[model samples]
Target: MISMHKIFRRLIVFSILLQLLIACPLQAFAESEEAIFAGGCFWCLEHDLEKLDGVVSAESGYSGGDLINPTYQDHSGHQEVVKVVFDSDIISYKDLLKQYWVNIDPFDNNGQFCDRGYSYKPVIFTSNQEQKRDAKESQETISVGLNIPLEQLKVDIVESKVFWLAENYHQDFAVKNPLKYNFYRSSCGRDNRLKKVWGEYKY
Candidate 1:
């Protein structure tokens, strides 16, 4: 038979475990997935993607560039990108792709809206083979659905590389600087072109 001291120790352990379970909910530790998208203006992309149901966080960054630790002013070849962290149980990767396409100008090879540069072109950076396959399929579906040739679509699917997070101020520019963000976005004609390309549908 166990001694009284042993029973007391077990009870203590159980109490500690109960406290841990209560303090940290299971959903707090739920597994999360990540997707990277390079669209024009990381501020706009971050704001749009984070508004999605399953998206837990969206961080503005730069990717697909030769520079190391690229900054907003220094990211010459880097594309303005957003890293989306989401819960897979709430939204699938396919759903993310579907939403991503509607947010940008899929046909513009030059740049997006008023942003003119290599850094402004949209891209999907896949983290794995499955992601690459899904991205390609999504691109194909868009091409076929629009009755446009696959070759004509400007969006490219590239394997993901290092993602350098932009400065903290740039992370949530839309929310932090709403007036300026709105002015810039409106003057850039981003929404107008998106409506023209996507036709009455909001992403």
Candidate 2:
């Protein structure tokens, strides 16, 4: 089981950010805000983030690859990413980063959930110096809460780039193909493994 101290710390971090958002919900995104992450199944992240109130849209795609416009079959080397678009008015990028931090094991620096490959590695793509700083600082927060060394986590914080959305079928795979999505999620050992790693913060 994960340590109670850590869960308490993360909860503190999450609550602090949410309080900031709730205080300033109308501070909308200055532009077409974007945040991309590669954490195992895009379908899972897509489904989860889409449920948030301020999230305008979320698309599954491939990033940090040599090839552009990659497909699921063609994503042999690229990490599957979820491109999230949100309105700043309803929430803040800092809060989004907080949620992202809670969702995966950043320490592995490899694949997330059941996947074990560079293609499934977790990363954050930021748009500016502010985001760069925020992502880095947030990584530190996660590292402290999880008792993971900074260098061991090895999370990448790169500049944001264009994202070519995955095929339509992958857009809403979880909803369109619930059974298959559930099977993929289960087979990946994501929930089970996460439960083992994170029982108290099993949200």
Candidate 3:
């Protein structure tokens, strides 16, 4: 039979182990971060960013405008954006910024590809100073690499505003309606434009 002292010691060890296990996951969760970007067609942007390994989720949303409870039909000032949750341990924000650049037509201030309007315009909404700094630096890098002037790189890097989640039907539309999503993407000339703007370098 086990002694009382042995049982007490075992319980102590077990409690410490449980605490450690709980703390580890909490620590890892703390590393999770959010990033917001608008590159036209929230469905496309949401689908594109979610393909990255470290990204936990990419949800379609509307942001960068004063509109409250914005929806798909009438989001006048708001731009269609993707809110990306990623594990910083696996992928840094700088890496994400690089990926964003190649996927967009930086010269198009009016909108991206076939989607023309204020809602379809490209933007990088930085939530903090670090993100803002990284975004501006990435913009500069893209300008130099593409041989375009800073003013010509139309992708705006600005402060992030309230990101209202889009309607449930809009979220994960690509995964839900693969055929329709593929047809729309192809017809919209998104990939073709990306290829022309970025050559063979895109994510």
State which candidate has the highest TM-score.
1
The sequence of per-residue lDDT tens digits that candidate 1 reaches over residues 74-134 is 9987899999999899989999999899989998868899998899999999999999999
State the lDDT of candidate 2 residue by residue for 1-203, as single tens digits.
98999999999999998888888644452455778987778898888787787888889998887787688888765788999998877768888887776666766667887778888888898878988998998878767766768787767888776677899998978899999999998888777776675567522
Comparing 1 and 2 by TM-score, which wins?
Answer: 1
Which regions of candidate 1 deviate over 4 angstroms?
11-25, 200-203
lDDT of each: 0.91, 0.80, 0.91
Sort by lDDT, top down from the best: 3, 1, 2
- TM-score for each model: 0.91, 0.78, 0.87
Q: Model 2, residue 190: what's the lDDT?
A: 76
Q: If both were scored by lDDT, which would come out higher, candidate 2 or candidate 3?
A: 3
Tens digits of per-residue lDDT, candidate 3, 1-203, equal: 99999999999999998998887866464679999999999999999899998998899999999989988887879999999999999899999998888888888979899999999999999999999999999988887887778999998889999999999999899999999999999999999999998896533
Of 1 and 3, which scores higher on lDDT?
Answer: 3
Q: Model 1: which residue pairs collide? A: none
Q: For candidate 3, what is the lDDT?
A: 0.91
RMSD of candidates 1 onward, in order: 2.1, 16.1, 3.5
Which 10 consecutive positions of candidate 3 have the poorest summed lDDT?
Answer: 22-31
